[model samples]
Target: LWGVELDPTSTDPRIPVVLSKFLRANPGDFKAAETSLRSILVWRANFDIPTLLTSEDFPEELGENIGVIRPKDVKGRPVVYHQYSGVDHKAAFGDLDRFVRWRVQLMELSMLQCDFLHADSLLMIHDYAGVSIFSYDRYAKAASKKTISILQDNYPECLAVKLFIHIPWWGTSIYKLVSRWIPEATRKKISIVSTAETLSVLLTYIKEDDLPKIYQ
Candidate 1:
C-alpha cells in the first residue's frame, strides 16, 4: 500500500468535509470511511498523475482511439470516449500488463483533464458497435477486470455515468457478469442502449453537437 498521511492544514479543505459526511452517512463505520479516504490519497500518489499528464506515452494512447473529448457534459463533467472496436488487445498492446499500464495512463490523462473543469466526475461513452467476443479474449478480460478494479477502488466517486451503446446480445451476457463486480451505486449510473435510437437518452446529459457522429 502507498503511504497515506492526513495533514489537515496542507490538505484540501473539501476533503475533510467529504470524509466527515462519509462517516456520518455510514454511521459507526468510521474505520471504513478512513480506509476509503486513505486509498484515495494513496492512489493520488501512486498513480503518478502529474507525470502522466506530461508524459509522451499519452499521445500513443490517444492516437490509438482513446481520448478525452473537449466538451463538457450538460452538468459540466468531462467526457471520456473509448472506441472498443479500435482496440486490439494482442496486436496493439502485445500483452496484458502493457495493455493495463496503457489503460491506467489513459485514465490518468482523462482525470487530469476533468480536474481542469473543476469536475470530480466524468461521463464515459464506450462504443461497442463492431466489437465481438474475439475482443474479449482472456487477455482483454483480465485487463478489463483490472481496469474496473482501479476505477472502483482507487478512483472513488469519479464516474458520474456510463453509456454503453450498440451492445449485441452476446455482449449483454458479458455485461451482466461484469455488473456483479461494480458497486450498486455505480451500477445504477450505467446504461446499456441496444440501438442507436435509444441513444437519445444520452442527449439528456450530453448535447447533440458534443456527441460523436456515430452516437448522433
Candidate 2:
C-alpha cells in the first residue's frame, strides 16, 4: 500500500520496507503498489480525485467526496520560496539511516516514472540520507552510484533543489558515493546546506559565503 512518514523526523521511511516485504510475499504484482502510491501522490499534490471520479449524476457510485477548498484571503502578496529541509521533527540521527537507504531506492524509481524529472519543481526531503550515503561503506559504493545517476538525471527544471545533510556526510566526503553518478557539469549545480547557519545564509539568498560546519 501507499506510505508516508507521519513524523518527518522519523529515522526510517518504513513505507518502502513494508512495500518491499509485500513485493517479496507476492511476486510480480505491482499494480496494487502502484495504485496505492499513486493515490498518495494525488493526495500530496492536492488533487481532488473524488471530483475527478464523480459527477452529480454518479454520486452514489463515488467512493469519496470532494469540496471547494477556499482560497486564503490574502490580497496580492508575494509567496516566498522556502528551500527543502528534510523534516522538522526532532529525532535521533541513527534512526534516520533506514530512510537514507529508502531515499536511494526512490531516486531509482524516478528513472522509470520520470515525473520527478519533468516536474516544475522537486523537493527531496532528506534528514541524514543525502549525506550519509557517502558513508555506506565501500561495498555499496557501486550501487549507490547507480542510484545517484538516476537522481542526477531526473532533477526538475529551474534547478530548484534543497538538501539538508548532517555530519561527516557533507563536503568532499560525499564525493565517493555520488561523484560518478553526476557529470562534472551537473555536479556544479547542486547546492548543499549542512548547517543551521548555512540555512540562514540560503534564506538571505546569498551564495559563495562561508558554509556552516556539518552537524551529525
Candidate 3:
C-alpha cells in the first residue's frame, strides 16, 4: 500500500494503523475483514489511486469548490470543507464518473496530510448556507452518492468526524441524500446545526485561525 509498510513486524507504526482500519470496519469477523481488505487492495490498484495523488489531471478550481482544505483541525487532523451552497453544482458534477475520480483525488490529497501513525482520520466540514431545494439537483445527488460509496467501501474509517453547518430547514433533504452512505457508527461522529449556531459549534472543533476565510 501506497509505499507505506503493512507488515506487523516492520517497525512502522503505520502498520498497526492499517490493521486497525480493517478490524474496526469489519469488527470481529476476521474472514470478512480479510475479504474486504483484498477487495480494497484490488479496487485501489484498478482505481490508480496512487497516481491520483501526483497527477494534475483534474481541474484545480473544482478542488476548491469541493474543498479538500489543507487546514488542520484542533487536534492536527486534516480538515475538508465541502461547500454545498452558491456553487455551480452542475458544472462540478456534470460528468459523474469524472467528478468521482476528482473527488477521490482530492480526498487522497487530504489524507496525505495525515501521518497515519498519529492522525489516521480526517475532520469533514460541510457548509450549506444559501442552498435552495433546486440547487442540489439529481446530478449533484448522484455524484455525492457515488463518491460516498467508493470512500466507505475502499477507504474505510478515514472520517473521524463531520459537521453539517449553516444548514437551512430545507437542507435536511440534502443531508438525507447522503445520510444512508454514512454507516451507523460513522453517524455517531456527525453534528448538524442551524445557521444561527453553526459558527460557535464549528469553532469548537476547528480553530478560527485554521478555518477557511469563507466560513469565518
Candidate 4:
C-alpha cells in the first residue's frame, strides 16, 4: 500500500516494513495485523488517497499555514509541523469535514515521504505559542476526535514522536483534550515543551538550520 506496486507474493522490501508496523502494533496477533492491514487498504480506496497526492484542490485551511511538512530531521525523518499561533480557530476549522480531510491528506503526504525500507516515521511538532489549552471549542473537539480516530485506526505506527512546543503553563489541558482519543501507547510518544526549551529540545532531533524561522 501507500502507492507501492506489490503483489501478495511479491518480496518488495517495503511490504515487510509496512506490514511489520501492523504486526508490531498488534503484538504477535497475526490475525489482527491482517485485519488492520486490510482495513487500511480499504480505507485508502474509499478515501481515494491516491488522488489526493496529485489533486491540487486541497482544502482552504492549507492556505492558513496551519500544518506543513518541513525537510527531514537529523535522522532523515520527515518533520511535520503544525502551528496554532495567531490562527482564528473558527475560520480555520469552520468546515469540520474539510478540515479533517486536510488533516488526513497532510498526514498521508508526510507518510509518503517515509523511507519504509529504512525505517522512517514522521516527527510531528505542534506549536501553541498564541493558543490556549482551552482553545478547542465544540467544533474543534468533534473534528479532533474524528481525525485522531481515523489516523490511529488507519495509520498505525506512523509517528516517531509528537512534540508540542511553545506551550503555556496550563497546556496540560491540551493533553486531557487530546489524550481521550490517543491510545496509551501513542500517548507516551507525546511531549509538551515549555517555551524556554522549545528550540533546545527540538534541536536534539532536528537540525537547527532546517527548523522554521519561528522556532529560531
Candidate 5:
C-alpha cells in the first residue's frame, strides 16, 4: 500500500501469518482480508516503524511522565494501558506539539511491543485526578484538541476502550464540551467513571497486578 511489497516471505514473517489466519477464519472473505492487510501495511508505513524504534528525537524529558506498561488481555485482545494524571500532564508536556509527537511515538512503541500478541487495538485509562480549573486554560485546551485530533484521525479503529477516571464535577462540564469534537463512534468507546467502585467495575477486564497501584 505504501510502495512496500506485501509479500509475507520477503517481508516480516508475522505479516503473512496474521493475514493467512484472518482469511482462514473468515473463509470466503478475500475482500475483507485484503482490506485488513492493507490497513496494517498503511499503518506500518505512516507510523514509520524503523524511525520510531531508532530515533532519539523524543527525549526522556518529554516522556518521563507517561508510560507504556505491561499489556493486559481483555476479551482476547491485548490491552495496553496509558496512565496520565493532570499533575503529570502539566509537569511533562509544556509544549503542546512536542507532547503530541511524544505521545504518538509512545503509541507506536506500544504497538510494536505488543505486536507479538496479535493485538490490533488498545485500551486507554486516563486518570484525571488532581485536575482543576487551571487544567482547562487556553493552552491546555488547545493542546488537548490537537492531541485528540491526532489520535482520531491518524490512528483509526485502534481504540477498543477509553476510561476517564476520577473526573471532578467541574471537569465533567469541560469534558462534555470538549467531547463534542470527538466522533460519535469514538465517543461511545469512552466511559466516564467518577467513583472508585465504578472505575473498579469498569476495569474488571484487566488484572489487578497489571493495573497501576493508584487504581488498585
Candidate 6:
C-alpha cells in the first residue's frame, strides 16, 4: 500500500516515523509486517540490522565477498572494503555464460510473480530496478514492456494493492537503459506505471502507527 524512501544512513530519521505509523494504523495486517521485515532482511545482509531496520552503505561491496584487503589494522584505523555494500548480480552468476542463464531464470520468476500472485495482502516492492528485475542482463525496452504487461494482466488492482516502489531519481537512467532492452511483453507492463503515482502510494502506507515498532 505504500513504500517509504528511507536513508540507510541514520535510521533514526524516518524508519521509526514511517514504520510505527504504519503498524499502528494496520494492526491486524501481518502481511504488511512481514513484507516490511523482508525488506529489512535484505538490508541486514549488507549492513547492520537495527531492530529489523536497515543501514545501507550502497555503492560498496558486501563484507562476505570483499577480498584483497590487509589482515592487520593500520594504526588502529578501521579497515574497509572497496566494494563494501553493493549487489553486483553479475558477479554472483560466475562468468558471462552463467550470468545470462541466471538473468533468464530471474526474468522467468519475475514473470511468474507478476502472473500468479494469489494473496489477499498487497505486495510492496522498492528499489530502482524493481522493474529492471525482469531483465537482469540489459534494459531491453521489449523486456520492460513484457513485465508491464504481465503485471497489468495479473494485478488488476494496482492502486488497491499495498505496493510501493521507491525508485531513486539518479537510477532512472540506468533503469531506463536496462528496461529498454527488455522484451516487449515486459516493457508493456512497465508503461502503465507512473513514477509519481508510485511514490504517492508508498507514502500513504507510511502511517504514524508503523513508526513506533521500528524504533524499538
- Quantify all predictions' global Cα lDDT against the true fold: 0.68, 0.35, 0.80, 0.82, 0.64, 0.35
Best by TM-score: 4
Model 4 per-residue lDDT tens digits across residues 1-23: 66565578898888777778899
TM-score of each: 0.79, 0.33, 0.92, 0.93, 0.71, 0.28
Pull out the clashing pairs in model 1: none
Off by over 4 Å in 6: 1-85, 104-126, 129-164, 183-185, 191-216
Q: How accurate is candidate 2 locally (lDDT)?
A: 0.35
Compared with the true structure, model 5 gives a TM-score of 0.71
Pairs with backbone N, CA or C atoms under 3 Å apart (clashes), candidate 2: 11-95, 11-96, 167-215
Worst 10 residues of 3 by lDDT: 1-10
lDDT winner between candidates 4 and 5: 4
Q: What is the lDDT of residue 149 in candidate 6?
A: 46
Task: Kindly indicate the candidate among 5 and 6 with the higher lDDT.
Answer: 5
Candidate No. with top lDDT: 4
TM-score, model 2 to reference: 0.33
| Model 5 lDDT per residue over 137-172, tens place | 666677678878777655556677877777777767
**In terms of TM-score, which candidate is stronger, 3 or 4?**
4
Candidate 1: worst 10 consecutive residues by lDDT? 1-10
Candidate 3 error regions (>4 Å) = none
How would you encode candidate 2's per-residue C-alpha lDDT over 86-159 as one tens digit per residue?
32222212333332333333332322222221232233322343334334444345444544543443221212
lDDT at residue 134 of model 3 (Cα atoms) = 85
Give candidate 4 misplaced runs (Cα > 4 Å): none
RMSD, one per candidate, in order: 4.0, 17.1, 1.8, 1.6, 5.2, 17.2
Cα lDDT tens digits for candidate 1, 47-72 = 66556556636335435474445578
Q: What TM-score would candidate 6 get against the native?
A: 0.28
Q: Count of backbone clashes for each model? A: 0, 3, 0, 0, 0, 54
Ranking of models by lDDT: 4, 3, 1, 5, 2, 6
